[model samples]
Target: MHVLPERIKSLRNVKGQSQKELGQALGKSREAISKYELGEREPDPDALVLFSKHFNVSSDYMLGITDHIENKAFGKRKPYSPELYAFEKYLKNQDFIPYLQLAVSMKDSHLDINSFKNPINKLIKQGKKQKHPK
Candidate 1:
């Protein structure tokens, strides 16, 4: 039950979805979704089923029975990568969503990570200054 709230929030953030977006997709209101994440309310069995289907995760995982979010019935799920997970957290913490979107858009456009070096450096400097102002 505790894990249900955490998993819901984690999955939503990982998918870059706001509560309103997820609620609309699931036919629930944004406030309901908020309550679910806040642990103020628990979803019914029907809502649980919808969540599993929408997130491609198993209900057992959502219930904290498993650490993996795999749904074998759907197909062989890809294993989670710790590095990718860490990078995702880093991006969220650093508020890099816009830059990440820009980087993703540049993909297959004959650009490399090197193309973002200057911007990345500037962002890092800004973060440092914000953390420790003179």
Candidate 2:
């Protein structure tokens, strides 16, 4: 697994626990703490849960599977909304913007790249015309 050593270390620092203290608290050897912080090995199931609870983060965040760590009780990151994710993906996709522009443009609104009036070019021309009408 692509666990985050630096993230773990950051959490450890936040918790203000020394390696020996944290190892004792987690019921593991000090060397285990070293391994976890070095990214040499991931924590076991029980230890994984313990770490998540200790750091108040999602297991996915601790495992580096997701970049989000939400605290819905406190409204920290809003628990990683799939809708927001979809919208973000759509907004970032280059095709989506031109398609939207093409749909909105009243003057020959066709966004296909091969179209005679490219939607992006049409939008740009419209903007220029609006700004500098003769």
Candidate 3:
């Protein structure tokens, strides 16, 4: 699948936003948003900028140039700590599907990291056993 359409659709779904709502926010018609997500039409440069700003993501991410979402250069958020940045870099190098699934599960459950300890440890043990069979 083309990265742009999939990214747009996924972000919208994750945000629980309808195409009409997104279009209204971006000052485009709902049809335009639908077209953009369907890959039948492309957002102009200005609309693309609006999307990046609206979603607080980098334009490069919206355009599929990078997988990192935050528009560090455009936003006013505090700088990422060195350790946090390192962790994020490491995650970027790993397979993303599992992380995405974990994120969705966490969001749905409203659970904190502490709540995942047992499951995580079980997975770790399973991995070790698989690597060093009896």
Maximum-lDDT candidate: 1
lDDT of 3 by residue, 1-134 (tens): 67778877877775668999988888888999999999999888998889877876778878877666664565644244323554665678645557667878998988897888889779768867987999
Steric overlap count per candidate: 0, 0, 0
For residues 71-125, what per-residue lDDT tens digits would candidate 1 score against the true structure?
4566755456323654656789646777777778788686898978898889879
For model 2, how does the per-residue alpha-carbon lDDT over 4-96 read when each residue is reduced to its tens digit?
Answer: 677677767756688888888878888999998998887788898888777677777877778776653465764554345446657888746
Q: Least lDDT summed over 10 consecutive residues: which range in candidate 3?
A: 76-85
Candidate 1 or 2, higher lDDT? Answer: 1
User: Which candidate wins on TM-score?
Assistant: 1
Winner by TM-score between candidate 3 and candidate 2: 3
What shift in Å separates residue 70 of candidate 2 from its native position after superposition?
1.8
**Which structure is stronger by lDDT: 2 or 3?**
3
Clashing pairs in 2: none
Error at 130, model 1, angstroms: 33
Residue 95, model 3: lDDT of: 52
- State the weakest 10-residue window (summed lDDT) of model 2: 78-87
TM-score of 2: 0.50
- Per-candidate TM-scores read 0.59, 0.50, 0.53
CA deviation > 4 Å runs, candidate 1:
72-74, 77-134
